[model samples]
Target: MLRPDDRGVLYGEGVFETVWIRDGVARLRDAHLARMARSAALLEITLPDPAPLVDEAEARWRADGEGALRLVCTAGPAGGEPVLYATVTPVPEAVIAQRADGVRVVTAEAGVSRERPGWSLTTAKTLSYAANLAARRSAGDRDMLWVSTEGYALESPTAGLVWLSDGVLHGVAGDGVLPSVTVAHLLSEAGGVHGEATVADLDRSDGIWLVSALRGLAEVIELDGRGRARSPWTGRLSRIVSRRPG
Candidate 1:
């Protein structure tokens, strides 16, 4: 729980990870732990060992099985020790439906500053999610595609973009974007195309997907009012991610 004066509550001095649990096992456990450690290090926060957390999650999974699991670490109140906790939540029915049927998305010029300003925690999964949440709200029921000021596709609020073109699987370079673990794993299996993407480039792609931990892989079926037929690879990719590492 957060105190009124906790740094995470007051200043968002925290990081969190969302993982998928299936058959009493947490998928991508190592990758999520590594990313949390990196984010904590970047924020100069001392993170506790994650082994116990993983063990506890596994125990919970054994009791209840599949669900969404969240791990949160906070810098705590001034001069206080850091706080850590884990929670499980039901995976929303809508998310499951979208994963099966794909999502209809709309692009919005988000004016994201890729320069990684001094105050920018872009590379870290920090607790300050106001901007990300707001952008999604602005989409008015449709998922929002974040674009940089220069017309490059950055990412969605909670997922990374991976598109296929000319038999090449293209992923937006991690430089100005969050280094998405899901996308990285997929690229390792399917090979990768390293580059930036504009709206037009995305339009010309053979397939496009929004990848995340919980959602796994969701194909983009429509964008900005234009409809795109579901790609033949969507089901295959979904199957691959459903068998996610445990």
Candidate 2:
């Protein structure tokens, strides 16, 4: 039970991880836990042993067949042990549709620069997502691609950006963006580069995708009202990412 006085309820002091489950197994479970642990450390929340939590999530997966498992850790009532829990739910149909049909995206100013201080929380997957949700609402249907105040492409409200140019796969990299496990896995399998990108760079790229845990990869078919030719690599890359890793 969550108390009103808990720091997570009162001030969003928490971290979370959403894992994609298939065939009674959680995909990238170790990577997700590692990232969650790092985020909890950054927030000064003591993380509980995740073995029991993983067992709970696995039980849900065994029951549901396919779904998303969300594990959360919150700073429980100040001066007390942190609250940890996990929940499982079906993956949204819309997210699945986006993977098949792709998505149209709009670029928006993020109002922040890429140069963040060492203490910045931008890289942490915390519970404070009001700003990101607000930006998505303002996009009004299409997904919003957040660009830094310096005009460099950062990421989407809920996903990471990856593009291909001259047969080279590239991922967005900077202090302002959250590290994406999905993107990292894809890059490791496909081989890629990590660097800063501008809107113009993406505009001319061979392909673009918004990668996430639940959604996997959604191609960007249109951007700011301009339509792009579907890339031949989309199908091949999708197959690469869909394979179950050992």
Among all candidates shown, the one with the greatest TM-score = 2
RMSD of each: 1.6, 1.2
TM-score of every candidate relative to the true structure: 0.95, 0.97
Which whole-number lDDT from 0 to 100 does residue 141 have in model 1?
Answer: 74
- Tens-place lDDT per residue, model 1, 1-246, is 789999999999999888888777788888989999988988989999876988887886654546788999999999998899988877777787778888888998877655667656788888989998998888887888888888889899999999988888888897668788888877777777667889899898889999998888999999888898778878777776778563
- What is the TM-score of candidate 2? 0.97
lDDT of 2 by residue, 58-143 (tens): 77566545688889889999888899998888889998888889999999999889999888999999999899999989999899
Question: Residue 12 lDDT in model 2?
Answer: 94
User: Native-vs-model 2 lDDT?
Assistant: 0.88
